[model samples]
Target: MTELNDQALLRYSRHILLPEIDIEGQTRLLNARALIVGAGGLGSPVALYLASAGVGTLTVVDDDVVELTNLQRQIAHDSASLGHGKAESAARRMRAMNPDIRVVPLAERLEGARLAELVAAHDLVLDCSDNFATRHAVNRAAVVARVPLVSGAAVRFSGQLAVFDPRVETSPCYHCLFPEEGEATDGPCATFGVLSPLVGVIGSLQAVEAVKLLAGIGPSLGRLTLYDALSGDIRQMRVPRDPGCPVCGERR
Candidate 1:
């Protein structure tokens, strides 16, 4: 895209005013494409803000339907969309919010080879899925494609954010922190329960990091940033690359 037009400069006045994200940065954001792996809690705010911020292309992938329980946090879908495919519902909302961007909905579970194919096409991927299995798959595809991956997870009152850019020689990956899949946990939002706004917090951060990564505005959360909503505390720690990790390690 060329330099922001006068209308665009007026539309994104706040963003353009920011020294970190001037007119040039907004143009970069307009040319980038991002793939979001899930359209649930974390995806809701992530998709919403990214669309509003002018991410040119956003592909939302999800196989689930909007259930009544999702109303607690998944803001992208409403009562009218109950039982509808989440990808479609979320895409509708995003497009309604910002008609300028292109939003694609993939109403199918991304698994096996499909995940790799979809991930390979996007400039970056966001892991908003709530399970280790999907997270691992997204991470593997990102590493294989050498695209930046912005991952965020939130449950109860806790949240985590990280960026795994295998393209960067020193960056660590998702598996580097949680080496093994471990026994599955019954901590889904329906089970253990999650704070409604907590997901928004983490997801919004993920969107900001994604935009920054695309616009070259600031440093990404290359390591891990942890948050405890209950205590209002935050911490950041470096994640070391694992030489033997299955995903991004020696297998490549």
Candidate 2:
């Protein structure tokens, strides 16, 4: 592990002071590579926090452009970013927050071999996309690369978060929890009228899980966290790997 410089030590003093993190864990974060598969609501906090925490390299992917409606929840972009690509916009904010880290912005929709290659290159992947197709695609790539994945979603007043570490023998992949064949009606926040800050709540948790996984801390694997913004309730449930799962199952 590379030794933290004087400036780095000062910038990350709070994390370095934590016994769970300390200098060693902070160093791990400095050397970590994270891939965030969205640049909207959830992706905003995930990218910003990971950058501020000193993740060495961050790759943010999104093909959409910032629109007037996104300003309410996508904190990474501002009015000046209107019409700009979401990935590039988010990258600019992340870079402004932490110039010590490297941010790569891919302004394109990822899938198939390209997606698999990207996931293989990263130490961790965060699924912040709104669609079921993207979630399943990212999960498949993470499973193939044996990379840990932090998945989060928010719509209306409901939000959910989960950590799937393919590195863990007993940890469940996203496919095991939400099979692709059973995908329900899904749409963007514009369709469901999501409450502002709901995505922030879930995305921040995703960032926490990503940092823990990168720093070798105990991550919330094999469980799903649910947040009900309406009732202000949080709950968690254990999720088990499926032996017949097509993505990460014994059959495969």
User: Candidate 1: lDDT of 33?
Assistant: 92
Query: 73-166 in candidate 2: lDDT tens per residue?
Result: 9999999999999999999999999998999999989999999999999999999999899999999999999999999999999999999988
Q: What would the per-residue lDDT of candidate 1 be over residues 132-230, giving only the tens digit for each residue?
A: 878888888898989889999999999999988877877888878876565545357877799999999999999989989888865564578999999
The lowest-lDDT stretch of 10 consecutive residues in candidate 2 is 243-252
What's the number of clashes in each of the models? 0, 0
TM-score of each: 0.94, 0.98
- Which numbered prediction scores highest in lDDT against the true structure? 2
Candidate 1 lDDT trough over 10 residues, lowest sum? 178-187
What does candidate 2 score on TM?
Answer: 0.98
Report, for every candidate in turn, its global Cα lDDT versus the true structure: 0.88, 0.93
Clashes of 1: 0
Best prediction by TM-score: 2
TM-score of 1: 0.94
The residue pairs in collision within model 1 are none
